[model samples]
Target chain A: MVSRAGVDEIRAILDGVRDPEMPALSITDLGIVREIRQEDDTVVVALTPTYSGCPATRVIQDDVVRALHENGIESVRVEVRLAPAWSTDWLTPRGRERLREFGIAPPSGIVDGPVVVSVACPRCGSFATRERSHFGSTPCKALYRCDVCLEPFEYVKPH
Target chain B: MRDSARIEYVLRFGDGALVLAQRLCAWVAHAPVMEEDVAVANVSLDLFGQARMWLSYAGELEGAGRDEDRLAFHRDAREFHNVLLVERPNGDFADTTVRGYFYDLWASLALSELAGSHDERIAAIAQKSRKENAYHLRRSQDWIVRLGDGTQESHARVTRAVDELWRYTGELFIGDDVDAVAVGDGFGFAPEALREPWLERVRATFAQATLDVPPDTWMQRGGKQGVHTEDLGYLLAEMQVLPRSMPEAVW
Candidate 1:
């Protein structure tokens, strides 16, 4: 079992971590964390991203190090996991609700399953949203515009 | 055409990337030079990743219960839609240079066109793949000229490879059902517009490589319809057998 202190440290350190573009939220809130393990004095944090070509990876890594260092943990290693590819469905319940409130639609379908359903537009309660582009502001999100509101939004393809 | 065509189109591009990646991977431990070897491996990884995306998307488009792995492994050689140029066995270093030269010229423009695809998925893949293609093109261009102008032996080898692969270049721009689906859905545009830049780049590269450019003669086309050389059978056998054998296998 992980020590209470270790868990709390992780939570504390991660609290300061903000996404490069969406600064108001932390990665923990984004649901990018897959697992965490500690061996000796080394902390290995395994992470998955919504997409492989995430441009903000460097910033995320830097923030991870900064957060840990400030808490007296200087030699932490942040390892990235490529398998079990992240899906937007990983977004936390609160994150999804927050996204809806922020005027951005939450993910439409469950990525792990095969059932396809129409995506709903957050701006307007319409099933008429369409994807405008696969690559968005960051590599992970796709560009989508709601036909109802006609407002283009950045969708977080949750990791 | 049915949505199945869309799946095939995605597969064709994916198989092209996967096959090329396999060939490039061959140079991982045996590149002509150390740095070049590492670069080749890195490029191979990128190609492999792109292949995964294309195959995955193709599977989704097909809605036939096949994911990336099944699509990759279960398909027979005749079922694959990759062009002959990519499947051409990697020869000497000069041969490799020529192969890359031909591909980069077409890929540079194909990706640029794809970046604007009406289909968001294709466009997204295009956006990322285009950046990689840009670098790959530059790298190939640098070497094309260097090898083309290098010693007599290097020049001759590169020239031979270029000539042999020229016939296959026509297959790149031919559109089919998948193109239709993407276009019909208002997600992409005609790939024919890519021919000009592709041709210009090819002409420039050939000049720099010290290789005489092949005349804009009548070109043969067929791969877009899935007709491939006999060699593809052996290749598919190796690339797909394990996955086919262990159908449910997953890590």
Candidate 2:
């Protein structure tokens, strides 16, 4: 029987697996790892994609499996679940900080609300920013320009 | 009857997403700007994802071998149940944005109600989809405001788009026998229940955009019954061409 401590150890291993698109942060940091359980000899990892059609979802699943296998765990199953949806609120504080360090602004405000919140410039840490476009390098990010720094950056969308 | 109603309800959701996604894809490399191109594509992908989920669930409810791809690629025009608003052509940027704005608002409202569905799977899918739909609504709303309140030419174009597409919007909230049954089964809401909220939101957005709401006139129908405008056939011919021509080829 896999102990609770074993599950923690496996989670620790997964913490090292970075998101393919944003390598500065791990999948755990992104909050896509829904649950980690040990059922008999199998380590079952339940995941939720950041977006329904995110092309990176398949890659993230593969990465989780690979990361577990590399840690000497041969019996692993990754299940993708779509419930309660994925909100940017799931992003860890560490993840948000890492995004800023990588010149990207983290999501701001509520996911389901219609409020228009200003995204601060990640580079200059200035509040003078405007959205250049509603899409960026990936589906989950939007392009913005900092009036203060005059530098363009990506803002991780709140959803 | 219950099972068929469930399938029909699911098809309504699936067809709307799939058809709109296909229309959005037609804008690839043809958008007014690079950023707009990417934005449209991402929205298209989001809708495509939702379509796959709904269609996959529809297939399961049918208990047949049909899957998302089969339902999408194999179905003829008469078999589709998407409202006519989605299958309409992507006329100009204004037309696309106006059509998208109308549909996205309706979809978001419907999905919000669906999230509370008694059917666990439907609720799960709705909960997942509503977030994306919210973002799509925001994007479309933003574009409508931009175009509607922009230069004279832009304002004129958007106004024309609005008037042209207004008639089709009525079909969104009109319930049919399938919708009635789905509502009875606790898996869906009455389409008419969403009309007021949809109208309120649209009115507010149009007010902000300085665009006039076209006066109500004779409304189009029959798309929900697998009847469509002439555009759908041409759209499907292009969309299904690759898949049909190379049935044996694996992509």
For residue A48, give model 1's deviation from the true position in Å. 7.9
Error of 1 at B169 (Å): 0.3
After superposition, the stretches of candidate 1 with alpha carbons farther than 4 Å from their true spots are A1-159
Go through the candidates in order and give the clash count of each.
Answer: 5, 0
Q: Which ten residues in a row have the lowest lDDT in candidate 2 chain B?
A: B242-251
Model 2: per-residue Cα lDDT over A84-144, one tens digit each: 7888989999999999999889998766578656889998889899999988778899999
Residues A1-159, candidate 1: write the lDDT tens digits. 348788777876786788786665678777777766787788777776544444466578778888888888867888766444455666778777877787666666675466454667777777777765433444444567778888877665422
CAPRI tier for the interface of model 2: medium
lDDT at residue B26 of model 2 (Cα atoms) = 92
Per-residue C-alpha lDDT of model 2 across residues B72-173, encoded as one tens digit per residue = 988999999999999989999999999999999999999999999999989999999888888789899999999988999999999999999999999998
The models' CA-based lDDT, in order, is 0.72, 0.91
lDDT at B27, model 2: 96
Q: Which candidate is the best by TM-score?
A: 2
